[model samples]
Target chain A: MQQRTILSTIEGHAAADPARVFCRFQTGAGTEAIGYADLLRRAEGFAGAFAAAGIGRQDTVIVILQHRPELLYGFFGAMRLGAVPAFMPFPSPKQDHALFWSSHRKLLALTGIRFILTYRAIAAGIDEHFTGLDVRVLYVEDILEGLAAGTVPPAPPAPAIAPEDVAFLQHSSGTTGLKKGVMLSHAAVLRQIDRYAGVLGFGPGDVVVSWLPLYHDMGLISCLMMTAVTGAELVCMDAFEWVRRPTMLLDAIEQHRGTFAYLPNFAFLHIARAARPGQRWDLGSLRALVNCSEPCKPQSFDAFLAAFGDCGIGRGTLQVCYAMAENVFAVSQTTPGQPVASLDLDVEALESEARIVPAAPGRDSRQVLSCGRPLPGAEVRILDGAGGDAAPDLAGQIAIRTDCLFTGYNHLPELTAEKLVDGWYRTGDLGFLHAGELYVLGRQDDLMIVYGRNYYAHNIEEVVTACDGIAPGRVVAFAVESRQMGTREAVVLLEPDGTREAAELRRAVKARVFDVLGLTLQHVEVVPRNSLVKSTAGKISRDQNRRRYMEERAGNG
Target chain B: MADEESFREVAQAIGETLMVDPATITRATTADDVNGWDSVTHSMLVMEIERRLGIQLPMDKVFDLADVGELVDLVAAARSAG
Candidate 1:
């Protein structure tokens, strides 16, 4: 069978299982189900509506909706009509009105998006924030109504498009600065899905559940697109609802017999802590729990397994994967049903010589799990500072040339040129190839340089997390430009339990970090637990933390 | 007197729970008034408030409370209504 675009796959499914449930959404109002046929019809209506609204081939349409089925319809419908859809995160409650307005304006300006499809609730919110953005807003309900009324005209002729034509624009996490639109073609997305699905052995029998926002690559491609292609049922929830009642997510999985799920490390921790005792549900149907999008700590894995072990989750079911938006969704996923393992290396040797050395007993070691080998058709290489490939077992910047690689960053040729060198995408992550497997250490931008030594913020965080009173994996370590030293110094921000005194927590963090990295911590800020900034996908926002720190210092001064 | 004591107790509890100095606790204080208040901390605050007061505060109110005064007022209203 020849491969097809995501839209064709959905249309085929609709033809085969017109009455079968494709997507389900449960809200306070009630539960709603959209069958395959209904989904296809709605998507066709959306495409017709877009055509009526003067949105044609190559035009960009912004989609801002919660985890409703309408998001999928709008996305596929726009893309099927050869229009590029840019998924933007709904405004966070923490964002001030001014900030939200400015962000919305900036996104509009960047994407040149004139047509926006969003829920009525969000449209009102945005209107209240900014008066005249000159963008045409269409309520989701109106589009659905038009579809129901059969007012939408017949589909226009399909635009001429190649396999490499840009399908949709995925924005980066915007942790570093302004978000960049990652240009992914239809073929690239399908290739990525095939790689992941092939590796995990996912099929029609699988049911994938996710609460990650649609704006994120992991959420869109892994949960929605992959499920559609594999004919797997999808269960999705809003992020806020998940955070508020995490047990509800588990209930959905058990109730729906969901077999596959993925969450970032922090969410794993949150769910483990939030799940109340004696609230029993049968999770025996769950076959895979892939943790990715951030570093998967052993502690989080253990906690989740222990919490759900009575309900049939086992050790081998916990797999860790590595992924980013640039390479589509996943680069490497631990083979399903494999026992998780880590490579324990001497911290000093790994940092100084860029080699993984076995740790002696009762000594400090950096344990980074092997993300497994690259997916088939994907080539992984570790490049030195000069872009030459590093030798095996040597750490350097990780790069990959894959059929699944994105086209480039949308409209940023210079930045795209810098990252995509001779068909190899520089991932900006420092890692090594050991015995043909990839082990990611940390991002090059997040590396802290202090006193002629290189220390990764994540490594420092791991050290501090070993302390009992401090919340594990909640530490944010960064390098602040020190005026006295004329270089960057390490500043560790920890969210400690209320019982720990500031001085004690600071001392403990400094001692542990220094002991592990052989470098003194310049500053330690002990804030309330859960104070760290995180991207929508729940990865720690280091640049945001640095900006907040600078803003605080400026305010204090 | 009872209301004031209850208010003070809630304020102190929030201060201690959030690791803010008790001296910094005030009726007009809010999450934004504090140095390191973010959404995660805000969630913690909501959880702590519920635990300390034995009240199930609405999620909207938990997110909408801009100051200590608003929190106290909401708590008081809930208490009186109950």
Candidate 2:
């Protein structure tokens, strides 16, 4: 028997269990069921269309479709022909069309991407504003219609693929120009599924319900690939729809008897707040609501349980997983039936001394949630400031070595070399180990997580500094803890150049940030020049400015 | 209150939640007209309206609301039904 890739595994499952439901995709109208056989056939139809349009093996195909069935088909179809497929987010309605399309020029040029699978409206937008790139835009509507009318030729035979071949690319979360494509191999993905699913006891008969976007690793690998490779069922809905009406998840879990779900900390809060008081549903089918992608805050889980405890949610039902795209998904996951561990540390000691000391009497304490133990083939180390492994219970930069680590960051050799050193990937997260479990203590880098998405503070700063009336190099962006919201909120402080009114400059900065990065800054403060603090390196210090901002806010309050 | 009054209240709630000018909002105002009025703030707006009006809007219908006018109508319908 040969080592199986994701394509081969899915094909095998389709042949063995043709009638099994692989995906129950819910649109705004209703749910559409696609069985294993149907999925394979539809994916092959897309493959045929791509073949007719000159997309061949190793060609990078960027799928920019909305959260529709074609998104799934286009992704797998490219893989079927041994072509590389990477999912990019469709431009939001609020985003500027010209900026969104133009931002992809560098990425497409670097990767030599010639084919973009998208819908009609996006294709028209690309044709009008996106220039200087000779790229072919293949519309999903036309292709599907052509396949139905028998106008397109049949798909060629499946190309031979090794397990080590690149399967797909997961673009990291950031502004468009700064996004790094993390290339994952077929073998690594399959290996991660085996280890991760084994830990969660996931297999056939388990329905994984999700409303996460397919562009990210948590959605692509955990829910989509895991179900496909393991022959389990997936109940998916559009992420935007879920955000507006979160109770749809409850209804789906009840209707489908869904056993598992992956959610970020903020979603737990969103759903809890959205549910009607005293209303109940039969959510007893859920075994684990795994908190992932964002930091696992115990308070968020508590709020969720307070809302749905009568619906069979409990402390044990809430698990936590520390995951990232570079690891191909899960580095550690709590056992399904076990309560997540937590530690209350003295805030002063932990913040000032970089030590994980237990809270003393009458001291301010911070409750840190445990990310459970590492998976079977993963190792975790805490690197001290001097680059050596730190002692247990000391907070430092986290590093991990996993069997499912990504091949490299596509087209960025320097970054790949800097991050991956001697088989250990230096994750910029700060954490400590206690009793064989990892306790994450925020980030060492300026990356912030808001509403389950990662945004670099430096990216926000860059966007802010480019706006008019802002002093260049006098802007700093950072995240502040928002306990009421159950997630971090981004704050930006910039010194103005006296060219525009403060209120006008503030509004312009907000609009520019929203238009560029699709993120709404929680607060923007325009101050006089020289108001910002600088580091010893003579650069605007984000950390020092953040501390000053917090102090000023507290003083005023 | 009449539909006009209800519409004013809806716009007020939207402005407060999204930090926009309430006077700028109108019956035909959709999410596209306001910056920072994406999915997350939409939910926040729903909750804010529910809190301010002391009524529970139907979750299914709230998700499909097209404009501020639809929201105003939904709140009225829920109030009458309640």
Question: lDDT for every model?
Answer: 0.74, 0.87
Q: Stretches of candidate 2 above 4 Å error? A: A128-130, B1-38, B51-82
List DockQ, one per candidate, in order.
0.12, 0.27
What are the per-residue Cα lDDT tens digits for candidate 2 across B18-54?
Answer: 7678999988876645645656778888888888888
lDDT of 2 by residue, A1-557 (tens): 66689988888888987888999999977899999888889899999999999999888899998888888999999998999999988877656777777777777777667888987875556765446777888999899899889998888998888888999999997777778999999999999999999999999879999999999788998899999989999999998878878888999999999999999888898888878767789999999999998888889988998999889878999999999999999998888988999999999989898989999889999998999999999999999998899977689999999999999998889999999999999999999999999888889888999888899998998888899998878899999887756778888888998899987887788878877787878778887789899999999998899898889978975
Residues A124-173, model 1: lDDT tens digits: 46664435556777788888887789887866876766668788988764
Model 1 residue A293 CA deviation in Å:
1.2
lDDT of 2 at A398: 93
Docking class for candidate 2: acceptable
| Model 1 pairs in collision | B29-B68
DockQ measured for candidate 1: 0.12
lDDT (C-alpha) at residue A360 in model 2: 89
Regions of model 1 farther than 4 Å from truth:
A1-3, A93-111, A119-136, A148-150, A175-177, A446-557, B1-23, B48-55, B72-82
Task: List each model's interface RMSD.
Answer: 9.6, 4.8
